[model samples]
Target: MPAGVTTEGCPDSIHQMEVERDDTHSLKRSMSTMQLTMIGVGGTVGTGIFFILSEAVPEAGPGVLVSFLIAAAVAGLTVLCYAELASTIPSSGSSYSYTYATMGELAAFAVGACLILEYGVSAAAVAVGWSEYLNLLLNNLFGIQFPDALSAAPDAGGIINLPAVILVVLCMLLLLRGASESARANAIMVFIKIGVLGVFAAIALTGFNADHFANFAPEGMHGISIAAGSLFFSFIGLDAVATTGDEVKDPKKTIPRALILALGIVTLVYVVVAFAALGAQSAEDFEGQKASLATIVQGVVGSTWPGTLLAVGAVISIFSVTLICMYGQTRILYSMGRDGLVPPVFAKVSPKRSIPLVNTFIVSGAVAILAGLLPLGILADLTSIGTLSAFALVSIGVMVLRRTAPDMHRGFRVPGYPVTPILSVAACIYVISGLHALTLQAFVGWISVALVFYFLWSRKHSELARLQAQAENLTGDQV
Candidate 1:
């Protein structure tokens, strides 16, 4: 084994050969430009604008509209950095994979730890939020409620999140069936989300009393910044488009175009939705109606049908979001396994489906437990910090690659060079600083677990042993 690299499980089960990748190990680049765009939109449009917007609008006041733009700018900068890295590398495992190949094994292990929280928590949070809307749509359309007693948590005053767990299980099944849902499904979901949001904006525009704008900056700039911190999580998934490297067709051309297109669409929809929502109701109303935007719609529209329809759309869209987040999580683990930072079991693909089953199962189980047990607000905050930290890494990696491996052929280059990536890092830090003190404490607590594991286990058994052995052989040959 290498001096610093380590692992948690058996490392000698497989030969310590420095494996070389060929065309087969590579992903079949079959996704079209349009499909790639769908992924970015699909990952971004779900749950965030539909559900979180209603929750955040109250915090930022009408200025939450401005918070939308602030969050988008930060996300857009990170997406640019991701675009460069994805095109230059053209592989899976997103950040962990990139860091391993460029930074080293220790960095990779630590990154994999953070990624587990980012995608996994995002998926679980969306599932829990989806469950809330599902219950709302059901009770309005039907007469029976799932009852708060069993629908939520004991802490939040519910028993078991049966709906959330069920949805997570269903998404896991879909992923296991050898059917990797394509990016087009995302585009369609984006259409539904946007179309419904458009209707929501149009209708709300009619009831637009300027009175809603009277205390627009009620929370003030500081409050808006704090609200933007909350909104940041909703924008976290945009980079999933960059994460699906090998799966994308003509990555150089398709990747950049898709990222920009998706960012534009997502930002427009979020800002418009926040504006219309604040117009329809006051910020004070958002706190009590935290679960679903439907309650807000009911207050404004007087009938339950519009709100019910909105709930139906959110339920459908959030289900897909759960799937994508889990998909990214598993792929990241699989990449780490393939790199020998963890166990090779994670890299072991199902011969029948070409999917990493072990990694998928592990992620699904953890996410299910989390969504079923934790409060929605805690999960949301945890996911935001994890994602921002990851985005910050990718941004710096892009800049480093520009310097260290300047000759490496890049399919896409971040426009404005150093300026863009610098701003990306700065923006991520700014929002991260705004995190509630409790959120910061929890994030520190979560990452400490990963660091401890890396130093204690992963470093001792890392695949970097293979690289060390090769170096030794070269020295012997020279002698």
Candidate 2:
């Protein structure tokens, strides 16, 4: 029998059964490497770059540039491991699917719970970010902004973020239409985001000052490490490329190519944008700016028009991020549902649209609630913790799969094998350690709830258990 194949009944064989059942309901494989790369760019280049500098720069000063590079290296290493796993198991669940096939149900469930933060909460974070940019755009264009009472989250002294809720609803509607449509929209948004950022960098660089670099390392090495940890959140969406392995035209080749392509593109953009911003203004100026890029542009251009343009781009780009992140969350849950780890309604695809309609709606609703009620700072930190945990698992899973199933066909293998995986894991741990204690506690609590659900509900209702029972009955009949 093949490595993934089982003789009569085994827990691991459930994936094969699920794959077989998915013939009729599988996602459409219409996306190419270009679209996949764009999706990665779209998913990653959201609020982290747009809003993170205000927080990170205050910690690392101008040396935050190095932090961006360090974070990119960590992201790059993880992307390599992800490419290998994605090719090995061309499923839509991303790390959750990879872990389920290689690890077990409980592990996958825990990872899925963390992924809720990575994708779902990140979507909420991005939506809130979109709302801020929308407010900036409105203020710049018409000299009017949403009253803080309606525009801000309760924690931020507002009742609810109506614009964020509206953005989530809009993305949800776009996603319900279909994957191909969403991918196309994402690609378009990616271009707009890059173009606008390019414009900002160009304009900002023209006013570059040597004075900003004078106090570069004032915060020392510790600050740089802290900034890198925060910047890690910016690189969260690279795995979005791997998650669409099932939706790509050529899983093996396309997934790996797209992963690297996306990583390189995103890293370059981040470095360039960071350099330009630092050069245009002193690091201290970014301390409390809500919309850092817009502020940078406005100062450089000496006008509100350019700032408005950047805000418009951010609004569009972050909307795509929310769309892709929400799409990822639903698919992960859909896979969990198929494995009987969650309710079946989550796995059911809409016949007309061929998308997980119910799951998407559930994710959108949850995301809207989070976006409407929570502040961006906490949401971003929580997203970082979830992403770091899930990414660490992917690194470990690569080494485990390589050792256990050395013969498995891998489309892209990590370059240094054990060393690369070791570094990836270590890097993830280092970054995770820098996360706020509260974020860690919240993550622990969240995972405990998921595990409790697994033991009390999922274990009994698991499809794997049913297969084992059927196999036992067959053996008894033979006896």
Candidate 3:
């Protein structure tokens, strides 16, 4: 029989899964808990808090605060499931790997496609947000701005979003250098983001008016739920910690700690910032505002300097979010490549640099094009739906794994076990149902394409499937 196969069949055991990781070309384990935690924070905190208020507040009024909490709760439950799976089967593919070990190849492929939409398209959406802030910073500080033809997407009345494209390229270059360098840069950016948010909160709170709370839930529960669906986009990066399992030191302990720590920090910052922003201005003002946080600060302080500071901070910090999102996308592709689900070039790591250089280039190029050509609103809705679907699958995978491999050594276990995972799935489904009808249609279309590719191409070339076939053939010969 082939290695990792049993007399009965190809079992989804840890040993069998280990056979998939090629030891000679594996990711370098240089990241610490702090770096991993920072990656999670860096990936998540910027675009959602910095720019999403403009989109979410209009949907829920002042009650967008409840939307933030709802989104965070769903994210928190999924994070618990992620922690358990990452501890039990530490790998680079995040939910894709978890699904594979617990479910099967087809399910893993579907989850991988969802991850592509979540990370790749999300990076594009974030880059667009960064562009908004960059333009604001430039106009405030230098009295100059890119022409709408160069700075906005075609759908948004521009030929292309050049700054967003440029930002993606810069991140790709940094990623090409190595993970350590990328993590260090991300750590610094995360601190800057947190500090800038703090300053905005402090300044904005000074102008808080109790009148803003008079009609808080003006749109009712339906509006709040829809806003929560949009706000869920903000929480997309928490699972990024799980993606670094293969690269972080002592992943079992490191991943769970990073996931929880990152979630706590993000949820607190989001709520505080939401409170400060909403208190400073009426919910109606958030609609169609670019660089909304900075605008809020400007209104509250009645000065250009404070808003300029916020814009500058946004431009810097949102870059970190794009970088980490792109990083996550490339790593997921690398994992898929190793499984023969995509082209082999994606799995090729640079021996000297200890990074997937080609993979980074491919992912960055695609993300840059999307950022430059597509409008941010569509990109964000697509990202939110894809992320929620992937989260739901991961939560289900946790329950499946517990039954299939109950003896697996998990360094961290979900405190509530079955209940927690069940809630995680339900929460994801609830939020997903609140998304726009068009978003749901687009997601279904994307998943259908993925399934087609899996059946026609991936199923034939899949490494795990090939191994199973070999084992079965050998067993038949012996009989």
Candidate 4:
């Protein structure tokens, strides 16, 4: 038949099965570009911008401005590259699906593994950050601490992370009720987060002290690059907008435009917020003031309630982020499982909930433990590395698909074509180059785990193989 059209029941047939497999349970192609833009805006704009400012600024001084610009530039190239691939592929599972259609089931599985880590760690990291702000809101509003033993991660001197666990469970419920909620809720939260940051901006700019910028780049360009590595995590959710291909109308025009719109909006917000925060407080103060956005706000507004309101806004924004990231992680894994990369159960969406229930629970269990155990800096590094790598792959996939399936219907094309994808890869590597050696080791560890899964189970048992074999045998027999 036509390309991307699968002939049923063939081993080694992933190339043929792409369109066929998604025929069932795939979402309706009904999302407007605006809706899709909001989805990306929703996922990418929260936790990192809200909570990461304090964590990142201290490393780069006011030179954190350069760091934000660097991260945004890298993400923009990836978004252009992603825009093309998502339209060509036009399906879910984000990078995992893109890799599958362009590469092979094996490459797809490894990408799936990486995406799982990216989305999963992202969800947990956001959750942990959410918890910090939640605790902050509680402490300021009611003088209640939720018992530090329960609020903190167990290893962090808490018995149970009730807030984190409760939030995960809460997000699970929301996701089960509606996948679309992830996007819509995310849009509203993005505005709130932007608004709060705006208030910070209005005040901080008025009192803007050029003195705080005197030591800009104090840690040197190396420090600013390291800060870029950290800030890159904030850009993670920008691609979630591309995942709406199955539901997006006129994806070629819609996807690319939306990608640009969402990226531009998110970058502007992030950069301005970082600048305002740097002006309001020194970068060195960020690490010590992790959950202190409200504290910084109070410095600007000169009112306890403004800080309280900001904390509440952060809590709301973070909760929504945790929910959306958790949902995205489970769905990516479910897509891989359906292709036979992991256990078939991962592909089995709950008849009751319509979610990939087994995958959700499994991912939830893993991330919960991570949230309860890992330090914030370590988790942020791991997430940034995974996302950068995935973005690079999607960028490269555009070139691969262009050469391999030259006539493929493309709804969107990267403007500069070949050169853009190449530069996208180069830029991702540049930011990744700035990552710490230890973080690189952790990323290597994660990749090794994914490859082990690929060789052990995914390669031979893959659904793609079965379909491919069947197709080849039929073609030979007919001849």
* lDDT of each residue in 330-447, candidate 3, tens digit only: 9889888888898889999889888888899899999999999999887887887778888999999999888877766778999988999999999888877766798899999999
lDDT of each: 0.74, 0.84, 0.87, 0.74
After the best TM-score superposition of candidate 3, give how far the Cα of residue 253 lies from its true spot, in angstroms: 0.9
RMSD of each: 5.6, 2.8, 3.1, 3.5
Compared with the true structure, model 2 gives a TM-score of 0.92
Write down the TM-score of every candidate: 0.87, 0.92, 0.92, 0.88
* Model 3 lDDT, full chain set: 0.87
Candidate 2: misplaced stretches above 4 Å? 1-18, 154-159, 214-216, 219-221
Clashes of 2: 0
lDDT score for residue 285 of model 2: 86
lDDT of 4 at 161: 67
User: Candidate 1, which segments miss by more than 4 Å at Cα?
Assistant: 1-27, 51-60, 147-150, 154-159, 178-184, 209-224, 278-300
Q: Candidates 3 and 4: which is better by TM-score? A: 3
Q: For candidate 4, what is the lDDT?
A: 0.74
Clashing pairs in 2: none
Instruction: Write one digit per residue (lDDT tens) for candidate 4, span 269-378.
Output: 88887787777776667786755566676777787887777786778777767766786787677677777778888777655544566677788788887776665555
lDDT of 4 at 26: 48
